[model samples]
Target chain A: AAGVIQSPRHLIKEKRETATLKCYPIPRHDTVYWYQQGPGQDPQFLISFYEKMQSDKGSIPDRFSAQQFSDYHSELNMSSLELGDSALYFCASANQGLYNEQFFGPGTRLTVL
Target chain B: DQQVKQNSPSLSVQEGRISILNCDYTNSMFDYFLWYKKYPAEGPTFLISISSIKDKNEDGRFTVFLNKSAKHLSLHIVPSQPGDSAVYFCAATVYNQGGKLIFGQGTELSVKP
Candidate 1:
Protein backbone atom coordinates (compact mmCIF):
# COMPACT_ATOMS: atom_id res chain seq x y z
CA ALA A 1 0.00 0.00 0.00
CA ALA A 2 3.00 2.25 0.18
CA GLY A 3 3.28 4.75 -2.67
CA VAL A 4 6.18 6.75 -4.02
CA ILE A 5 7.27 9.67 -1.83
CA GLN A 6 8.67 13.04 -2.86
CA SER A 7 10.27 15.74 -0.74
CA PRO A 8 9.50 19.46 -0.43
CA ARG A 9 5.90 19.21 -1.59
CA HIS A 10 6.23 22.82 -2.72
CA LEU A 11 9.38 24.68 -3.72
CA ILE A 12 10.03 28.29 -4.70
CA LYS A 13 13.24 29.49 -6.35
CA GLU A 14 14.57 32.51 -8.17
CA LYS A 15 16.15 32.56 -11.60
CA ARG A 16 19.69 31.10 -11.75
CA GLU A 17 19.17 29.31 -8.44
CA THR A 18 19.41 25.58 -7.84
CA ALA A 19 17.04 23.05 -6.36
CA THR A 20 17.24 19.39 -5.56
CA LEU A 21 14.13 17.24 -5.37
CA LYS A 22 14.30 13.84 -3.73
CA CYS A 23 12.17 10.74 -4.14
CA TYR A 24 11.72 7.53 -2.16
CA PRO A 25 10.15 4.83 -4.24
CA ILE A 26 7.85 2.21 -2.83
CA PRO A 27 9.63 -0.67 -1.18
CA ARG A 28 10.95 -3.30 -3.59
CA HIS A 29 10.21 -1.12 -6.58
CA ASP A 30 13.21 -1.11 -8.91
CA THR A 31 12.27 1.55 -11.42
CA VAL A 32 11.81 5.27 -10.92
CA TYR A 33 10.53 7.90 -13.34
CA TRP A 34 10.26 11.66 -13.25
CA TYR A 35 7.68 13.79 -15.03
CA GLN A 36 6.86 17.46 -15.24
CA GLN A 37 3.41 18.90 -15.76
CA GLY A 38 3.21 22.53 -16.72
CA PRO A 39 -0.02 24.45 -16.27
CA GLY A 40 -2.52 23.47 -18.98
CA GLN A 41 -0.08 20.91 -20.39
CA ASP A 42 0.27 17.19 -20.19
CA PRO A 43 2.80 15.47 -17.93
CA GLN A 44 6.05 15.18 -19.86
CA PHE A 45 8.54 12.43 -19.28
CA LEU A 46 11.79 13.74 -17.89
CA ILE A 47 13.91 10.71 -17.10
CA SER A 48 13.98 7.25 -15.57
CA PHE A 49 16.23 4.88 -13.68
CA TYR A 50 16.21 1.13 -13.39
CA GLU A 51 18.07 -0.61 -10.61
CA LYS A 52 20.12 2.48 -9.88
CA MET A 53 21.13 3.01 -13.47
CA GLN A 54 19.83 5.70 -15.77
CA SER A 55 17.65 3.85 -18.22
CA ASP A 56 15.98 6.53 -20.30
CA LYS A 57 15.73 10.23 -20.89
CA GLY A 58 13.11 12.51 -22.40
CA SER A 59 12.75 16.29 -22.69
CA ILE A 60 14.78 17.09 -19.60
CA PRO A 61 16.82 20.23 -19.96
CA ASP A 62 20.60 20.41 -19.88
CA ARG A 63 20.51 22.29 -16.62
CA PHE A 64 18.74 19.38 -14.99
CA SER A 65 20.44 16.19 -13.84
CA ALA A 66 19.13 13.18 -11.92
CA GLN A 67 20.39 9.94 -10.49
CA GLN A 68 19.27 7.04 -8.39
CA PHE A 69 21.27 6.28 -5.29
CA SER A 70 22.44 2.92 -3.92
CA ASP A 71 19.40 2.74 -1.69
CA TYR A 72 17.17 3.13 -4.76
CA HIS A 73 16.17 6.66 -3.85
CA SER A 74 16.48 9.25 -6.61
CA GLU A 75 17.22 12.94 -6.77
CA LEU A 76 16.57 15.48 -9.49
CA ASN A 77 18.89 18.45 -9.42
CA MET A 78 18.09 21.55 -11.40
CA SER A 79 20.55 24.40 -11.78
CA SER A 80 20.27 27.88 -13.24
CA LEU A 81 16.52 27.54 -13.09
CA GLU A 82 14.32 29.57 -15.37
CA LEU A 83 10.76 30.74 -14.99
CA GLY A 84 9.64 28.24 -17.62
CA ASP A 85 10.80 25.51 -15.25
CA SER A 86 7.86 26.10 -12.96
CA ALA A 87 5.60 23.05 -12.93
CA LEU A 88 4.44 20.10 -10.88
CA TYR A 89 7.15 17.45 -10.67
CA PHE A 90 6.10 13.89 -10.03
CA CYS A 91 8.02 10.75 -9.13
CA ALA A 92 6.68 7.31 -9.95
CA SER A 93 7.89 3.84 -9.11
CA ALA A 94 7.26 0.40 -10.52
CA ASN A 95 8.64 -3.09 -10.62
CA GLN A 96 11.21 -3.08 -13.34
CA GLY A 97 11.14 -5.80 -16.01
CA LEU A 98 7.85 -7.06 -14.61
CA TYR A 99 6.16 -4.02 -16.09
CA ASN A 100 3.83 -3.43 -13.20
CA GLU A 101 1.75 -0.33 -12.64
CA GLN A 102 3.81 2.80 -11.94
CA PHE A 103 2.57 4.38 -8.73
CA PHE A 104 3.01 8.15 -8.51
CA GLY A 105 3.78 10.33 -5.54
CA PRO A 106 1.92 13.45 -4.38
CA GLY A 107 4.22 15.62 -6.51
CA THR A 108 6.37 18.69 -5.84
CA ARG A 109 5.16 22.00 -7.16
CA LEU A 110 8.11 24.10 -8.25
CA THR A 111 7.61 27.81 -8.74
CA VAL A 112 10.54 29.64 -10.37
CA LEU A 113 10.51 33.38 -10.15
CA ASP B 1 5.58 16.54 -31.98
CA GLN B 2 2.69 15.56 -29.75
CA GLN B 3 2.60 11.81 -30.35
CA VAL B 4 -0.29 11.27 -27.98
CA LYS B 5 -3.40 13.41 -27.94
CA GLN B 6 -6.72 13.92 -26.21
CA ASN B 7 -8.85 16.17 -28.35
CA SER B 8 -11.43 16.93 -25.70
CA PRO B 9 -10.34 19.23 -22.91
CA SER B 10 -13.36 18.57 -20.68
CA LEU B 11 -16.61 16.68 -20.40
CA SER B 12 -19.70 16.79 -18.21
CA VAL B 13 -22.13 13.98 -17.47
CA GLN B 14 -25.00 13.50 -15.09
CA GLU B 15 -24.46 11.17 -12.19
CA GLY B 16 -25.66 7.63 -12.95
CA ARG B 17 -24.99 8.22 -16.63
CA ILE B 18 -21.98 7.08 -18.62
CA SER B 19 -18.86 9.10 -19.37
CA ILE B 20 -16.56 8.42 -22.28
CA LEU B 21 -13.10 9.83 -22.85
CA ASN B 22 -11.03 9.32 -25.96
CA CYS B 23 -7.29 9.29 -26.72
CA ASP B 24 -5.14 8.81 -29.79
CA TYR B 25 -1.53 8.01 -30.49
CA THR B 26 0.68 8.16 -33.55
CA ASN B 27 3.33 5.70 -32.48
CA SER B 28 2.74 2.23 -33.80
CA MET B 29 5.49 0.78 -31.66
CA PHE B 30 3.68 1.54 -28.42
CA ASP B 31 2.77 -1.75 -26.78
CA TYR B 32 1.19 -0.61 -23.54
CA PHE B 33 -1.36 2.03 -22.62
CA LEU B 34 -2.75 3.26 -19.34
CA TRP B 35 -5.24 5.68 -17.84
CA TYR B 36 -4.56 7.74 -14.74
CA LYS B 37 -6.94 9.89 -12.70
CA LYS B 38 -5.76 12.96 -10.85
CA TYR B 39 -7.33 15.37 -8.40
CA PRO B 40 -6.39 19.04 -8.39
CA ALA B 41 -3.47 18.77 -5.97
CA GLU B 42 -2.63 15.09 -6.03
CA GLY B 43 -0.53 12.95 -8.28
CA PRO B 44 -2.21 10.76 -10.85
CA THR B 45 -3.53 7.42 -9.72
CA PHE B 46 -3.41 4.44 -12.02
CA LEU B 47 -6.82 3.45 -13.26
CA ILE B 48 -6.69 0.64 -15.82
CA SER B 49 -4.47 -0.48 -18.67
CA ILE B 50 -4.40 -2.64 -21.76
CA SER B 51 -1.51 -4.13 -23.62
CA SER B 52 -1.14 -4.17 -27.39
CA ILE B 53 -2.09 -7.84 -27.37
CA LYS B 54 -5.56 -7.04 -26.04
CA ASP B 55 -8.38 -4.96 -27.44
CA LYS B 56 -10.28 -4.42 -24.22
CA ASN B 57 -9.83 -4.48 -20.46
CA GLU B 58 -12.34 -3.95 -17.68
CA ASP B 59 -12.14 -3.28 -13.98
CA GLY B 60 -15.20 -2.63 -11.87
CA ARG B 61 -17.07 0.35 -13.35
CA PHE B 62 -14.30 1.22 -15.79
CA THR B 63 -13.60 -0.30 -19.19
CA VAL B 64 -10.91 0.50 -21.70
CA PHE B 65 -11.17 -0.22 -25.39
CA LEU B 66 -8.16 -0.17 -27.64
CA ASN B 67 -8.35 -0.02 -31.40
CA LYS B 68 -4.89 -0.89 -32.57
CA SER B 69 -5.62 -0.13 -36.18
CA ALA B 70 -6.84 3.33 -35.34
CA LYS B 71 -4.00 3.90 -32.89
CA HIS B 72 -6.67 4.96 -30.48
CA LEU B 73 -8.02 4.05 -27.03
CA SER B 74 -11.09 5.00 -25.05
CA LEU B 75 -12.10 4.80 -21.39
CA HIS B 76 -15.68 4.37 -20.25
CA ILE B 77 -16.96 5.03 -16.75
CA VAL B 78 -20.38 3.62 -16.04
CA PRO B 79 -22.87 5.01 -13.53
CA SER B 80 -20.76 8.13 -13.24
CA GLN B 81 -20.45 9.40 -9.69
CA PRO B 82 -19.37 12.81 -8.46
CA GLY B 83 -16.39 11.14 -6.84
CA ASP B 84 -15.20 10.08 -10.28
CA SER B 85 -14.82 13.65 -11.40
CA ALA B 86 -11.20 14.51 -12.13
CA VAL B 87 -8.66 14.89 -14.90
CA TYR B 88 -7.93 11.64 -16.72
CA PHE B 89 -4.63 11.23 -18.50
CA CYS B 90 -3.83 8.76 -21.23
CA ALA B 91 -0.31 7.39 -21.45
CA ALA B 92 1.57 4.96 -23.66
CA THR B 93 4.93 3.22 -23.68
CA VAL B 94 6.82 1.94 -26.63
CA TYR B 95 7.97 -1.63 -26.31
CA ASN B 96 11.54 -0.48 -25.92
CA GLN B 97 10.91 2.79 -24.12
CA GLY B 98 12.01 1.18 -20.84
CA GLY B 99 9.34 2.53 -18.49
CA LYS B 100 9.06 6.05 -19.81
CA LEU B 101 5.43 6.99 -20.45
CA ILE B 102 4.38 9.49 -23.05
CA PHE B 103 1.22 11.18 -21.87
CA GLY B 104 -1.57 12.92 -23.70
CA GLN B 105 -3.17 16.16 -22.74
CA GLY B 106 -5.67 15.14 -20.04
CA THR B 107 -9.44 15.37 -20.24
CA GLU B 108 -11.29 16.78 -17.25
CA LEU B 109 -14.56 15.06 -16.42
CA SER B 110 -17.25 16.51 -14.21
CA VAL B 111 -20.03 14.24 -12.98
CA LYS B 112 -22.95 16.35 -11.88
CA PRO B 113 -25.67 15.13 -9.59
Candidate 2:
Protein backbone atom coordinates (compact mmCIF):
# COMPACT_ATOMS: atom_id res chain seq x y z
CA ALA A 1 0.00 0.00 0.00
CA ALA A 2 1.43 3.33 -1.04
CA GLY A 3 0.71 5.82 1.72
CA VAL A 4 1.91 9.33 2.34
CA ILE A 5 1.58 10.50 5.95
CA GLN A 6 0.71 14.08 6.79
CA SER A 7 0.91 15.80 10.16
CA PRO A 8 -1.71 17.98 11.90
CA ARG A 9 -4.87 16.48 10.48
CA HIS A 10 -6.57 19.74 11.52
CA LEU A 11 -5.14 23.12 12.34
CA ILE A 12 -6.40 26.54 13.39
CA LYS A 13 -4.43 29.74 13.26
CA GLU A 14 -4.97 33.46 13.46
CA LYS A 15 -4.43 35.77 10.54
CA ARG A 16 -0.87 37.02 10.00
CA GLU A 17 0.49 34.00 11.80
CA THR A 18 2.80 31.45 10.21
CA ALA A 19 1.80 27.82 9.77
CA THR A 20 3.90 24.81 8.90
CA LEU A 21 2.69 21.50 7.52
CA LYS A 22 4.71 18.33 7.10
CA CYS A 23 4.50 15.39 4.76
CA TYR A 24 6.34 12.09 4.68
CA PRO A 25 6.31 10.34 1.37
CA ILE A 26 6.00 6.64 0.87
CA PRO A 27 9.31 4.85 1.13
CA ARG A 28 11.12 4.26 -2.17
CA HIS A 29 9.32 7.17 -3.84
CA ASP A 30 11.54 9.94 -5.13
CA THR A 31 9.01 12.58 -6.05
CA VAL A 32 6.82 14.64 -3.72
CA TYR A 33 4.09 17.13 -4.58
CA TRP A 34 2.18 19.71 -2.57
CA TYR A 35 -1.22 21.07 -3.44
CA GLN A 36 -3.73 23.51 -2.01
CA GLN A 37 -7.45 22.88 -2.16
CA GLY A 38 -9.67 25.88 -1.54
CA PRO A 39 -13.29 25.64 -0.59
CA GLY A 40 -15.68 24.81 -3.43
CA GLN A 41 -12.73 24.68 -5.77
CA ASP A 42 -10.30 22.22 -7.25
CA PRO A 43 -6.87 21.47 -5.93
CA GLN A 44 -4.08 23.63 -7.29
CA PHE A 45 -0.47 22.65 -7.59
CA LEU A 46 1.81 24.39 -5.13
CA ILE A 47 5.24 22.91 -5.79
CA SER A 48 7.10 19.72 -6.53
CA PHE A 49 10.40 18.30 -5.35
CA TYR A 50 12.59 15.59 -6.77
CA GLU A 51 15.91 14.31 -5.51
CA LYS A 52 16.13 16.93 -2.74
CA MET A 53 15.86 19.81 -5.19
CA GLN A 54 12.91 21.98 -6.08
CA SER A 55 11.66 21.02 -9.53
CA ASP A 56 8.61 23.19 -10.19
CA LYS A 57 6.27 25.66 -8.55
CA GLY A 58 2.85 26.79 -9.55
CA SER A 59 1.61 30.36 -9.61
CA ILE A 60 1.31 30.82 -5.89
CA PRO A 61 1.98 33.77 -3.66
CA ASP A 62 5.52 34.44 -2.52
CA ARG A 63 4.46 33.83 1.07
CA PHE A 64 4.17 30.14 0.31
CA SER A 65 7.36 28.07 0.32
CA ALA A 66 8.35 24.41 0.56
CA GLN A 67 11.39 22.35 1.43
CA GLN A 68 12.38 18.74 0.81
CA PHE A 69 14.81 17.17 3.25
CA SER A 70 17.47 14.50 2.79
CA ASP A 71 15.18 11.93 4.39
CA TYR A 72 12.58 12.58 1.65
CA HIS A 73 10.26 14.39 4.03
CA SER A 74 8.83 17.70 2.85
CA GLU A 75 7.49 20.76 4.62
CA LEU A 76 5.28 23.60 3.45
CA ASN A 77 5.45 26.96 5.15
CA MET A 78 3.04 29.82 4.88
CA SER A 79 4.15 33.20 6.13
CA SER A 80 1.61 35.81 7.14
CA LEU A 81 -1.38 33.64 6.52
CA GLU A 82 -4.54 35.37 5.38
CA LEU A 83 -8.14 34.31 5.78
CA GLY A 84 -8.07 33.11 2.21
CA ASP A 85 -5.20 30.81 3.08
CA SER A 86 -7.59 28.48 4.87
CA ALA A 87 -7.86 25.28 2.89
CA LEU A 88 -6.99 21.62 2.73
CA TYR A 89 -3.43 20.71 1.82
CA PHE A 90 -2.59 17.42 0.18
CA CYS A 91 0.70 15.61 -0.28
CA ALA A 92 1.35 13.11 -3.02
CA SER A 93 4.29 10.88 -3.92
CA ALA A 94 5.40 8.70 -6.79
CA ASN A 95 8.34 6.56 -7.77
CA GLN A 96 10.60 6.75 -10.82
CA GLY A 97 8.48 5.65 -13.71
CA LEU A 98 6.93 7.32 -16.71
CA TYR A 99 3.57 5.86 -15.82
CA ASN A 100 4.05 5.70 -12.08
CA GLU A 101 0.99 6.10 -9.92
CA GLN A 102 0.87 8.94 -7.41
CA PHE A 103 -0.63 8.17 -4.00
CA PHE A 104 -2.09 10.71 -1.58
CA GLY A 105 -2.25 11.19 2.17
CA PRO A 106 -5.23 12.25 4.18
CA GLY A 107 -5.07 16.02 3.80
CA THR A 108 -4.32 18.64 6.46
CA ARG A 109 -7.14 21.10 6.86
CA LEU A 110 -6.08 24.60 7.82
CA THR A 111 -8.63 27.06 9.16
CA VAL A 112 -7.34 30.58 9.38
CA LEU A 113 -9.30 32.73 11.79
CA ASP B 1 -6.81 29.67 -17.35
CA GLN B 2 -8.52 26.53 -16.13
CA GLN B 3 -7.18 23.85 -18.40
CA VAL B 4 -9.40 21.09 -17.12
CA LYS B 5 -13.16 21.32 -16.63
CA GLN B 6 -15.85 19.16 -15.10
CA ASN B 7 -19.15 20.87 -15.78
CA SER B 8 -21.22 18.88 -13.34
CA PRO B 9 -21.06 19.88 -9.70
CA SER B 10 -22.87 16.83 -8.36
CA LEU B 11 -24.45 13.55 -9.36
CA SER B 12 -26.88 11.17 -7.76
CA VAL B 13 -27.33 7.52 -8.66
CA GLN B 14 -29.16 4.55 -7.27
CA GLU B 15 -27.15 1.71 -5.86
CA GLY B 16 -26.28 -0.98 -8.42
CA ARG B 17 -26.61 1.59 -11.22
CA ILE B 18 -23.75 2.77 -13.36
CA SER B 19 -22.19 6.13 -12.50
CA ILE B 20 -20.37 8.12 -15.14
CA LEU B 21 -18.03 11.03 -14.50
CA ASN B 22 -16.68 13.13 -17.33
CA CYS B 23 -13.76 15.49 -17.80
CA ASP B 24 -12.41 17.70 -20.58
CA TYR B 25 -9.07 19.33 -21.07
CA THR B 26 -8.03 22.19 -23.32
CA ASN B 27 -4.40 21.18 -23.46
CA SER B 28 -3.51 18.85 -26.27
CA MET B 29 -0.23 17.92 -24.62
CA PHE B 30 -2.08 16.00 -21.95
CA ASP B 31 -1.62 12.32 -22.78
CA TYR B 32 -2.11 10.58 -19.47
CA PHE B 33 -5.39 10.72 -17.56
CA LEU B 34 -6.39 9.69 -14.07
CA TRP B 35 -9.48 9.66 -11.87
CA TYR B 36 -9.32 10.20 -8.12
CA LYS B 37 -11.96 9.74 -5.45
CA LYS B 38 -12.01 11.62 -2.15
CA TYR B 39 -14.14 10.85 0.84
CA PRO B 40 -14.93 13.58 3.35
CA ALA B 41 -11.81 14.85 5.09
CA GLU B 42 -9.57 12.51 3.08
CA GLY B 43 -7.21 13.24 0.27
CA PRO B 44 -7.98 12.07 -3.20
CA THR B 45 -7.13 8.44 -3.99
CA PHE B 46 -6.25 7.08 -7.41
CA LEU B 47 -9.18 5.17 -8.80
CA ILE B 48 -8.18 4.43 -12.39
CA SER B 49 -6.09 5.70 -15.26
CA ILE B 50 -5.75 5.58 -19.03
CA SER B 51 -2.90 6.39 -21.37
CA SER B 52 -3.25 8.11 -24.73
CA ILE B 53 -2.15 4.97 -26.48
CA LYS B 54 -5.42 3.25 -25.60
CA ASP B 55 -9.02 4.38 -25.87
CA LYS B 56 -10.18 2.47 -22.84
CA ASN B 57 -8.80 0.74 -19.77
CA GLU B 58 -10.75 -1.22 -17.20
CA ASP B 59 -9.92 -2.54 -13.77
CA GLY B 60 -12.57 -4.57 -12.01
CA ARG B 61 -15.63 -2.35 -11.61
CA PHE B 62 -13.84 0.84 -12.66
CA THR B 63 -13.13 1.80 -16.25
CA VAL B 64 -11.55 4.88 -17.78
CA PHE B 65 -12.03 5.86 -21.40
CA LEU B 66 -9.82 8.38 -23.08
CA ASN B 67 -10.44 10.12 -26.38
CA LYS B 68 -7.28 11.88 -27.42
CA SER B 69 -8.80 13.43 -30.49
CA ALA B 70 -11.50 15.05 -28.44
CA LYS B 71 -9.21 15.74 -25.54
CA HIS B 72 -11.71 14.20 -23.17
CA LEU B 73 -11.97 11.33 -20.71
CA SER B 74 -14.64 9.63 -18.65
CA LEU B 75 -14.80 7.27 -15.70
CA HIS B 76 -17.48 4.63 -15.33
CA ILE B 77 -18.25 2.80 -12.14
CA VAL B 78 -20.36 -0.31 -12.36
CA PRO B 79 -22.92 -1.11 -9.68
CA SER B 80 -22.30 2.02 -7.71
CA GLN B 81 -22.53 1.57 -3.97
CA PRO B 82 -23.22 3.90 -1.12
CA GLY B 83 -19.56 3.66 -0.24
CA ASP B 84 -18.83 5.30 -3.56
CA SER B 85 -20.36 8.55 -2.40
CA ALA B 86 -17.57 11.06 -2.58
CA VAL B 87 -16.01 13.79 -4.66
CA TYR B 88 -14.33 12.69 -7.89
CA PHE B 89 -11.62 14.68 -9.57
CA CYS B 90 -10.19 14.05 -13.02
CA ALA B 91 -6.53 14.73 -13.60
CA ALA B 92 -4.26 14.82 -16.63
CA THR B 93 -0.53 14.88 -17.00
CA VAL B 94 1.56 15.97 -19.90
CA TYR B 95 3.86 13.40 -21.39
CA ASN B 96 7.29 13.47 -19.72
CA GLN B 97 6.27 16.28 -17.37
CA GLY B 98 7.69 14.56 -14.30
CA GLY B 99 4.22 13.28 -13.44
CA LYS B 100 2.81 16.70 -12.62
CA LEU B 101 -0.95 16.40 -12.73
CA ILE B 102 -3.46 19.20 -13.41
CA PHE B 103 -6.88 18.60 -11.94
CA GLY B 104 -10.42 19.64 -12.75
CA GLN B 105 -13.08 20.93 -10.42
CA GLY B 106 -14.43 17.84 -8.70
CA THR B 107 -17.91 16.39 -9.01
CA GLU B 108 -19.65 15.10 -5.91
CA LEU B 109 -21.29 11.72 -6.38
CA SER B 110 -24.03 10.45 -4.09
CA VAL B 111 -25.21 6.87 -4.27
CA LYS B 112 -28.61 6.01 -2.81
CA PRO B 113 -29.41 2.81 -1.06
Chain A TM-score per candidate?
Answer: 0.97, 0.95
- Write model 1 residue lDDT over A22-77, tens digit each, in one string: 99999999999999999988899999999999999999999999999999999999
Model 1 lDDT on a 0 to 1 scale: 0.93
Q: Which tens-of-lDDT digit does each residue in B1-113 have in candidate 1?
A: 98899999999999999999999999998888999999987899999989988999999999999999998899999989999999999999889778688899999999999
Off by over 4 Å in 1: none
Residue B27 in model 2: lDDT: 90
Best by lDDT: 1
Error of 1 at A38 (Å): 0.7
Worst-scoring 10-residue span by lDDT in model 1 chain B = B93-102
lDDT string for model 2 (A1-113, tens) is 65899999999999999999999999988889999899888888888899888877886789988999999999999999999999999999987484347898899999999
The top-ranked prediction according to TM-score is: 1
